[model samples]
Structures are given as structure tokens and as C-alpha cells.
Target: MDIKTATALHRLRLASIPEALSFPALLIFGTGFRLALDYDKLVMPLGIIHGVLFIIYVVLLLDVWNRAKWPFKRVALFFLLAVLPFGGLFGDRILKREEQAGVIAARARKEGTVNA
Candidate 1:
């Protein structure tokens, strides 16, 4: 894919990772409130949001994998990272590195074409 498309897809992949990560954090606080504070009301909605975001993150991961033609290991690593605390941020950095490199190559190629 072209650099712009790659960058956009990378962004989506990175964004989704955080959305997936947020779910468990919310769940922890929500559960603590329910058990410790005895506040159970409206806790279920956070779960629903988390579920939806998790689904979206999975979908975006699949899309980026398909478009980028990433190796199985790379994809698996990213998926695994999502499960770890603060792992999503690491994955985002990797994605940004790949995206920026692609963009740089694209620019060089375009410049070469114009110069020729």
C-alpha cells in the first residue's frame, strides 16, 4: 500500500490498542467501587463500552495486518502486547516507526520521479 494509506492504517491500529487497554482499567475501578464502596449502579455500562472497544480494536488489528501483510509473529506479538499493562504504548511506537519509514521512502520515490 502507499505511504499515506499505510500511515492511516497504522494510526488506526495504534489507536485501537489503547481503546482495548482502557477496558480492564475501567473494570478494575468499577469492581473496586462495587465491592469496597458498595456502589454497583452504572458499573455495567463501562463493561459494555469496553467490550465494544475491544471488538473495534480487534477489527482494526485485522485490517492493518491484512493491508500491511505483516508476518504471523509480528501480528501475534501485537495481540499479545494488548493484554499486557502499558504494552499498547510500546506497540504504538513500533507502528509509528514503521509508518514514518514508509512515508520517508514514499517521499524519496516521489522526488526521484519528479527529478527524472
Candidate 2:
């Protein structure tokens, strides 16, 4: 609940939004390009971009999971959401709600601990 944890969570939450969206976008574009289109040139670049975003998402997810000390169920849910199309939106909503509620920061403040 300290600042470090809060910051890491925030970063992860932000990163996840784009990462989640990119996957679906890539899928849609890929399908469209493959069928009824001659724009095959776009596939590789988009695939690479989505791949990188996915890697970033996984790394951030791990870092946040470790810092937050979240339960296994929560970690699994996030991981599952990452692979689903449009799932990132749901994840973002949950994270935003939790962030606004100040769940972690409030707990840290109540404990009278430093921002570490």
C-alpha cells in the first residue's frame, strides 16, 4: 500500500489499457487484411507491436502482482483477461475503481507507514 506499490500499480494499470486494446485491434486488422484485402504488408508490423505490448503487459503484471501481494485468484484473473479481446477494458475499469477508492494508499496511511 505504500507509494512504491501504488506507483507500480498505477503504471501497470496504465500499461494494461493500451496493451489490452492493441491485441484486439491487431486481431481485427489482421483478419480484415487477410480477407477481402490486399494489405498483407500491415500484418507483420502490427503483430510485432502487439507482441511487444503483450510482453510489457506480462512484465508489468508480474511486478504489480509481487508488489501488491494480491491473491492467486486475482493474479489468474488478470492473466486471463489479458488474452481475451476487449478484456483490458474490464480490467481497466476494475483497476480505476480500486485506485479511486484508495484501497492501498488508505491502508498504508492507516498503518502510519512511510511512503516506501
Candidate 3:
């Protein structure tokens, strides 16, 4: 891949991590506010925040999907991870691994070296 595409992929991957995390954080806060505090006011704002984050996560997922050309299973897995509590942390680790692998592969290709 060219430098620009690689850079964009990197940015998308990085952007996804925070957005993914935000969803769950808001989820916990919303749950806490609703169940423990018995407050409805916090629900709307937290819901809005989660909604926005969900949209961002989906958009980033699409960008990553297009750029990475990941298989359907992997794509679905990432989508699944987006919804589960603390799943974003797992997703972030996977993305980090992918990024590292891509960097290594790119370096190898650029250096005209083949892995065995």
C-alpha cells in the first residue's frame, strides 16, 4: 500500500479505539444513573453520547473495512466487539496487532526483504 492509504488506515484505527471505548463508558454511566441513582435526566444525554459514538464507530469500521479488506468474519467480530462491555479494549488490542503487523510487512517490502 502507498503511504497515504497506510496513514489513513492508521488514523482510522486509532480513532476507532476511543470511539469504541466511549460507548461502553457511557453505557456504564447510563446504567448507573438509571438503576442506582434513579435519575432519568442522565439517560438522555448519555444515550445521545452513546449514539454519536456508535455512529462514529460504524463509520470508522467501514473505513477500516474498506482499507483493510478484512474478511466478513473479522468484520463481524469487530462489529460484535463494539457492542459488548469492555469489548473495545479487546478490539484495540487486535487493531494494535494488525497495525504492528502491517508496519512490519511494509518495512519488509520496502527493504526488498522476504520473510521466511
Candidate 4:
């Protein structure tokens, strides 16, 4: 792929790492622990932070999907993984693998075009 597309994939892959862990962190702090442990001060801020990150991640996911020319199913699956309880880790790995495959295939296609 071109530099811009490649960059998007790279960024999305990186973002998935944090996106994976942030949900549970947000859930833990925003929910049970706060009431059970007396952390009222933390709820609003943590919820806000998680909301921002979630928004950012969704935007990035869409951008990467478009830039990478991904299938609708791929994008949908990624979104599903993003929202699942512990799906982020799997999502990150899947993105990494997909990104690598896309880059490699793009490189091969470019080489074939140049050779032709």
C-alpha cells in the first residue's frame, strides 16, 4: 500500500493495544469498584476518558477500514471485537496480522507491477 494507507494500518494496530485494555479499566473504575470502594470522584472522569477513547477508536477503525480497502465484514468484526469484554487483545493480534498481510500483499503487487 501507499504511505498513507500503511500509516493508517500501523496507527490502528497501535491504538488497538490500548483500546483492548481501556474498556475493562473503564468498566472496573466506572462501575462496581467505585460504589464498593468509595471512589465517587473517579467515576465521571474515568467514564469521560473511556468515552473519548472509544470514540477515537471507532473513528480510527473507520479510517483504517477505508484506507486499507477492507471488507465490510472485517470492519464489522473489528468493531464487534472492540466492544466485547476481553476482545481487545484478540482484536489487536488480528489487526497486527491483517496489517502485515496487507502490507506484504501490497508490496508483492507493486513488485509485480514494476516487473511487468
Query: Candidate 2 lDDT, tens digit per residue, 1-116?
Result: 56677777787788888888898788678868877687787788888998898889889889978988989899889888888978877898887776665665667677878353
Model 1 lDDT, residue 11, Cα: 66
RMSD to true structure for each model, in Å: 2.8, 3.3, 2.8, 2.5
| Residue-by-residue lDDT tens digits, candidate 3, 21-109 | 67667767787878998987887888888888778777877877787777889889988887776687788787777777777778888
Q: Name model 3 segments beyond 4 Å from true.
A: 1-5, 111-116
- Estimated TM-score for each candidate: 0.81, 0.83, 0.77, 0.81
Question: Best-fitting candidate, measured by lDDT?
Answer: 2
lDDT of 4 by residue, 1-116 (tens): 66578778788777776776777877675777778987687778877877777788889999988887889998999889888866867888877776787677678777785342
Model 4, runs deviating above 4 Å: 105-116
4 Cα displacement, candidate 4 (Å): 2.1
C-alpha displacement of 37 in model 3, angstroms?
Answer: 3.6
Estimate the lDDT of model 4.
0.78
lDDT of 1 by residue, 1-116 (tens): 46756766676655756575675677777888899989997489877877776677667777788878889998898877776666777788788777777777678778785342
When 1 and 4 are scored with lDDT, the better candidate is 4
Ranking 1 against 2 by TM-score, winner: 2
Which runs in model 1 stand beyond 4 Å of their true positions?
113-116
lDDT of model 2 at residue 55? 89
